[model samples]
Target: MELEQDLMVSERKKKPFRWHVLVFLAPAVIVYTMIMILPLAETLRFSFFQRDTITQAISFVGLENYIKLFFDPYWVEPFLNSLWNNCYFFLIHMLVQNPIGILIAALLSMVHLPGKKLYRIAIFMPTLLSFVVVGFVWKLMLSPLWGVSKGLMKSVGVGSWYLPFLGKEETALTTLSLISVWQFIGIPMMLIYAALLSIPDEVIEAAECDGVTGISQFFKIKLVLILPTIGIISILTFVGNFNAFDLIYTTQGPLAGPNFSTDLLGTILYRTFYGQQLQPGDPNMGAAIATVMFFIILTGVAIYLFFIQRKLTRYEM
Candidate 1:
């Protein structure tokens, strides 16, 4: 009874305060709230209001702008176009970029490859350059007048298929998507490569002893282990693709030209927020668009977290 009473008394004592810990977090918290949260809150506020064109008067309009965005044919048409285009862009990345990345990483992960460092560098070099550089470089090369792409096509005996890809409605979006893929393929390759490298050699040796070799070892063992990494990359790709603007803007301008065939949400937001040839800039409408985008992204993240992420098993190394 005496020993138990002593233990209870000790446990009842209050823990020491740590005020110093707050100093480390204070700077980051304040900066993030100011930079990210503040702007987001302000944008949200703007979305529920309306501003008159002539008088420049502001008034609360509730969901009017949002309704217009979705139901008003003039607005809904462009909005839907951008949304579908964005989805297609993301789907292409999921299909093309990721598979190619997996293939390259699988190859690079194997031993005894010569000049592997050089190959890695060559693959990743485009990612290091600015969107401006990559966009302009490709644009110039693909220009009909320059004839670089034409010349190469001719040499390969497929010159007849060559056209001004960037200026055509049918090819503009796909051409840009491929360009984006080429620039960013390095990221997934490196991520998947790192994940593969981190797998335990002991695990591999055990699998080998059990006669799990060649493609069987890769598919049954290596691929399964790296699934969590793939999940992270997928979510990252989703967020990045939705937020993409720099490349399109730099290459095709804010109009996302060739009849807006390549127009995405980012470009649409830009054109709306800043005023294009016909539409005057309306902060309220712009804010409404932005608010909708935030929810769309949030929904995607939620689905990924609750559904896809839970399905993947994380193995302890």
Candidate 2:
């Protein structure tokens, strides 16, 4: 009976001290729930209701807002255009940014690179600046009046190629996407670099012993180990790109000017929620757009988690 009592006491003593964990986590949880989740849920709820113009009375609209958004030609065209443009923007980042980031990170990881710290700092410096700052700076640099890009192109004997990229409908979206990539490339580089650093030196040395050196070593060893990190970076990129707003807003203005050439989902949401010069504000429609965006982002994340991530094996090394 004494042994049993002692064992019970020991088990009680061994129980985790959850109070400290709760104390540490409570503030962040409360803040996140209040600020993000609650507001998001409220927005979703608001999408199903309509407000009266005269009495400002609200009434349940079922899927009326969604139906109008899809079936109505006026709203449907711009919404689809913005959706497609957003997808293109995301595709550009995935193709250009990730590869460039990986290359930069791989170069930085080289043991004997001269002034490596300086290079890293210089590369990462752009990412620290606000989206507004990046957008304005790039806008000025690309401005035909400023002639900075033209001068550089002239120096490279490609002066004829210099054009008002931002003003042209043909090139505006791609230009904006590339500008975004330039500013944010540091993120993936830092992530991949950290993943590379986490790798055991002994494992790399063993690969070297087995005649795996240079690019061969990176592909066969480092690449395999960093697959999990790459997967994480990809998902994060998807979320960030889908949610992107500030840079486009600052650079192209709320109208996404030059015949709405650069209109993205973020800009579309802005125009919908807040009245533009030509278009009137529709809060219910805005909510519906927001809901659609939320679902699109959720779908992308789900695909990544279930399909892409499952195939990526994170090795113990």
Candidate 3:
């Protein structure tokens, strides 16, 4: 009888606290499914169908949309252009933003820096602002009317270099990408800074005793320890850059104008779904585009995980 009672108690103990788990997880799971997973699945499904012209009825099209998207010159050209532009944007963030973030993080990690908290707060304030605000703020700063950029350049004896960057097809995309980098550099900075802070003082002290001080110590000791954090930051940047929309949309408008030179996958998806001046909206095509984007992002992430991340050996410090 005692054994039976103990077994019952043990079984009860082993049983999951169902209400507790539900309380902790239910809301997040529900919201994530409804907002992200469901919509994504529905969009993928919609990509495989076409709507009737007159009746507005959706019919199964299998690979027809994909076929057209790849082969049709009109669609293919813009699609490829946007894809390349998006790649450039991602590359710039990787090359420029991440390095700059590392440099800033390194500087902020220095113990002798005065008012470090103030500097951190100031630097990170931009990331806290909405994309719309950043876009508009940069637009004004770069505007000829305001002369902010020009004035700064003039002060440095390079006033003649100032041009209407956003109005030029050649520079528009790059300019917008830089603006985005400026706004979000804080994210990687903060992440890396935190990782740097988490490093043991004993390790740093030992390195210092070994005659590794200043930048050399940082490069050899601190940076090696922060590789895992850097990996995380890189992946986060990848996902965010690939899914980016609002900054480009706000700064360049939905059309990604200057003769569509700044067009990215996000803007293209928006234009296809909602239509613009000359083109009528095509939901099927839009869904197809979105589905393609999803695959592209997934493929990039997979490559990062399998190739780049696997090669990066993270040291426990």
Model 2 regions more than 4 Å off:
6-26, 53-55, 111-114
25-139: candidate 2 lDDT, tens digit per residue = 9999999999999999998999999888788899998998999889999889988888888899989998999999999999889857579988889999999999989999999
Q: Candidate 1's residue-wise lDDT over 4-76, tens digit each?
A: 9988888777556667799889999999999999999999989999987788899898999999999999999
Off by over 4 Å in 3: 1-24, 111-113
Question: Which pairs of residues collide in candidate 3?
Answer: none
lDDT of 2: 0.91
Give the best candidate by TM-score: 1
lDDT value, residue 140 of candidate 3: 91
lDDT of 3: 0.90
* RMSD list, candidates in order: 2.0, 2.5, 2.6
lDDT of 1 at 239: 91
Model 2: per-residue Cα lDDT at residue 16? 85
Q: Give the range of the ten consecutive residues with the poorest summed lDDT in model 3.
A: 308-317
Native RMSD of candidate 1 (Å)? 2.0
CA-lDDT, candidates in order: 0.92, 0.91, 0.90
Sort the candidates on lDDT, descending order. Answer: 1, 2, 3
> Best candidate per lDDT, number?
1
